[model samples]
Target: MPCWFTLTCAVLSIFAFVCVLGSEVNVQRKNLLGLGSLQSVAVSGRLICLGRPAADVKVKLYESEVLLDSKLDEGRTDSNGVFRLSGSKREFTTIDPKLNVYHKCNYNGLCDKKFSIRILVDYVSSGSEAEKTFDIGTLNLANEYSGQTTDCIN
Candidate 1:
């Protein structure tokens, strides 16, 4: 996949798309703005839709940005509904990471239901890789949470 698809632009007040594109569309240029060291994070969890395993659910790790969010890693759930992902980003300030979950769950809809869980700064480690892994435990996709939205594109 192209790098630009991973950079999800934040929704405006009217839910319109806004992207700041230049001649270059690589992630290295985005990191040049920061002289800080590399910070990393690792996460693992299982997803269950209704009462059964939710296989093939899309999961992404991102360092949230004002204009373009950097996608550290992206993958899908295994047959057992298990997923493990680790990624890093270099930033002058503390890296704000978020795990975006895109799943259909038990609903028959035109788009997948999207939800995000913010990784606390306490879990962020300064290095080329993460020293510790944060266990998100089992997530049941049967209930609605705040900031949840429908994503037609993932």
Candidate 2:
């Protein structure tokens, strides 16, 4: 074969091998992190922004994993500023669950300001669905919360 053609073929082969190795490594990482058997959790809460209902706000439930966090469920607050969200993730170990509230309370900007709260690992149930709901009580978004951040993407 021509020298240039041989070099190009070898480079292509190496690239293909790298891609396959990367995929296998990713699978192994997830396996070690234990994101594989079903577990569920449920959360409920009310949000008030400036003494009014925090309507249409976004709320997301996430499984906090070592490799990559997984989004389980998402919902919006009702006219009364109430939300009930439940979701399940498959993990070989206990799942780390959290709730993310994306609201426009007390701010005028693009996307939404994010406030996150972690759910106790005890709340995670051993099944495909949650056995009970965990209420987080009411929150007044007018007051600033520590660890708040801005998230443009959901």
Number of the top-ranking candidate, with lDDT as the measure: 2
Name the Cα RMSD for model 2: 5.8
Q: What TM-score does candidate 1 get on C-alpha atoms?
A: 0.78
For 1-154, candidate 1 gives per-residue lDDT tens digits of 5555445433342244223334234445766876567899988899998879989999999999988899999999999899998999888689998899998887789999999999988889999788888788999987896899999988
Where in model 2 is the C-alpha error above 4 Å?
1-36
lDDT of 2 at 110: 92
lDDT of 1: 0.85
TM-scores of the models, in the order given: 0.78, 0.77
Q: Residue 108 lDDT in model 2? A: 92
* RMSD after Cα superposition, model 1: 11.9
**For model 2, what is the error of residue 94's alpha carbon versus the real structure, in angstroms, after optimal superposition?**
0.5
Q: 1-154, model 2: which lDDT tens digit per residue?
A: 8999999999999999999999978876886787577789999999999889999999999989777789999999999999999998766678899999998898999978998899997789988889988899999988887899999988
